[model samples]
Target: MRAGLATLVLLALAGYVFLHYQTGGARAPECVVTGTGTGEPYRLQPQQAANAATIQAVASSRGLPERAVTIALATAMQESSLRNIDYGDRDSLGLFQQRPSMGWGSEEEIMDPVYAAGQFYDHLVQIPGYTTMPLTEAAQMVQRSAFPDEYAKHEPQAAMLTAALTGRAAASLYCTSAMDPAPGDPGEIRGRLAHEFGDAVRTDHSGRDITVEVPEPELSPQGWEVAHWAVAHAAEFGVERIVHRDRVWEARRSVKGWQAAREQDTADGLLITVAP
Candidate 1:
């Protein structure tokens, strides 16, 4: 077998071990992010990946740089492990653990990942030179956490996530299809895309397949942004396959991560096929 195929075989086996390998009964949906040359992969529960996607989408909608994304991710990873949890120390809640008592937002608003991420950016941008400061310092200025340096520990992983989610690094993320008994709903995916990425995201649906046209106006982070987003939510949304540029990932074969797509799939935009 060729080198790439060999890599795929190993990765598929890895996926089997982590994704489908038995542990008591069954496994929850999961996503793995690599491609930072770290030689180590970062794993996320479906919910964590979904929350990170929201955070990245929020930053992109505001035209923030990758640095901002990295900072926000690290903060979220440190705060609540990227889950929109309902509780935290004291009154802290949501991904950033923003306390409603401290004026971040109402308890309901803060628990919404999109709202919470937006609130975090609203404060992040106000910092005079947040982009230039050290990651921990920038995060500290926004979140008055007791241990500021803790954010630094997650910076590397956060940076890796940023690269893949931002479209800077292609084909770096994939997930085992979530085993929802219901067939995937194209409309649901469309609405969620709009909610997190805004109505500006161009998309189309033909049955269970959703095609997202690359944001022609801005290619910098458009295509892969949606590509990774689709994959990260695959397990949660029942997405069976995703194709972008020259790569493809299938729910049934997710362990291979992103394999080289066939010649015919070499289109500009990407395609997402949901469970039937």
Candidate 2:
């Protein structure tokens, strides 16, 4: 009887271990969706979506890959649904729900989505072997969640959001906010670009918008610099279109003939299309 009982116990233990390994030692139910089941198309709140774009732009400016962006987005989605809310578990606050009491920063600084996301990424990149691990494990390592495995469930949607926002895959990230155009200061834009890409920047003014063109040799090295600068100044200049070689990118503004094909390598250099 004792021998038979021992055999059964061993088999049970083996089965449990197998199941644990198979499920990556995390509970499967933790990742299950619990939100509304209405199959209607749902959009994120305007400010939340804008915050996602800002995070993506900041990450891209740092030259981080799409995976990092996805991880950051997923973490943010899980935390605050990409909203820069001013509350969370205990004293935790901001987009990542980081506690200001825990050396993250002051309450106001932590509430800033860009600052919070940047700090989160700064810490995330430090985890050893984080890139190779599963998304849930990596995120869990960073967040130490009570339900550690839940972060995995958001990976697919997070990947889609990152692609859409980063301009990696072709998809529009639209927001329904009222159009408020702010013409960016040309001098500031030029000074910033010159600081980043040296003095290779050429400046021109077309109506109310200022187009800053960079040289061809600097294009490869300075693409991100220019791209980030443009995105940062997007709200300003009521930026209608961003035209690079063979690609004409449009933003929210009234732009007529802004999509014209470009064959003129004008004296300035490569064309950077902006709007009034």
Candidate 3:
């Protein structure tokens, strides 16, 4: 009887393993976060990854340091899990949960991720020595949340996200997305780029391919910022591939993340190819 029971247990375990592999259980889409030099990575969903990227972009465009990005991200993670939502604690809405009643912005403006981020930074810089202040204290100065200490726990994850989004974690940001063949709209891409990076991003389209140029030389961080942003929004924008520096990310095999690329005339600026 004992021998028979053991055999049944073994069979059940085997069946479960087989079923797990057959269903793509462990292979589901996810976002990966790694440290700049060396540290364990953190994993989260694609939407969170997009929100992180947007927060970083808005901060960088304002010429804020990576420290500012870390604080903003930590605050958002604690407030809304990095999501731009329409609901929050009474009168609060969007990431960072800024209350419209407190003069952060109109409900419609706060809902815009870029504008919300800008508002957060605008207040953050006003705090004397916010750059050197403790993460929790700095965040509290702006939020005045009932539970101020909650922001501390999120700082490590926020730092990791800042590293990846700001290009310090080189080749570290990627999102798993469904395969879609439709081409992205060049007009929309140009507009979004302008909104984030300002009018400095020179955009021109040739057929389905959209080219964005940051004419200044040796702007690796700035270039990578744009490249990673394209990757984060690839599925939404139908980006086929992104080439910057010596690495390339292609939609067909984006699961592998950034990879070494073939030599090309990338001297003028980073190149992004959109799908048709």
Highest lDDT scorer: 1
Q: Which pairs clash in the backbone of model 1?
A: 178-235
- lDDT value for candidate 2? 0.59
lDDT of 2 by residue, 1-276 (tens): 999999999999999989975644432211111122452223455455556666776676566777887888888889988778877899989878898778889998888666787788888888887777789888877777788877888887777666555544321333221133454455555554444334444566655455655456233434333443354345533444555444343443212212333556222323344443
TM-score, predicted candidate 2 vs. hidden true structure: 0.60
RMSD of each: 7.9, 18.3, 4.1
Candidate 2 regions off by >4 Å?
A: 1-45, 170-207, 210-238, 246-276
> Model 1, range 129-153, lDDT digits (tens) per residue?
9999999999999999999899999
**What value does the lDDT take at residue 37 in candidate 3?**
54
User: Candidate 2: worst 10 consecutive residues by lDDT?
Assistant: 27-36
The true-versus-predicted C-alpha distance at residue 212 of model 2, in Å, is: 5.8
lDDT of 1 at 241: 79
Better of 1 and 2 by lDDT: 1
- Against the unseen true structure, what C-alpha lDDT does each candidate score? 0.85, 0.59, 0.81
Model 3 C-alpha lDDT per residue in residues 1-276, reported as the tens digit of each score: 999999999999999988865554435666777665577777877777777788888887788999999999999999999888899889999988999999998999999999999999999999999889999999999999999899999998898888778877667787655455367777787788888767546678887667766555365566777777777777777788787777887776666778888767343567788887
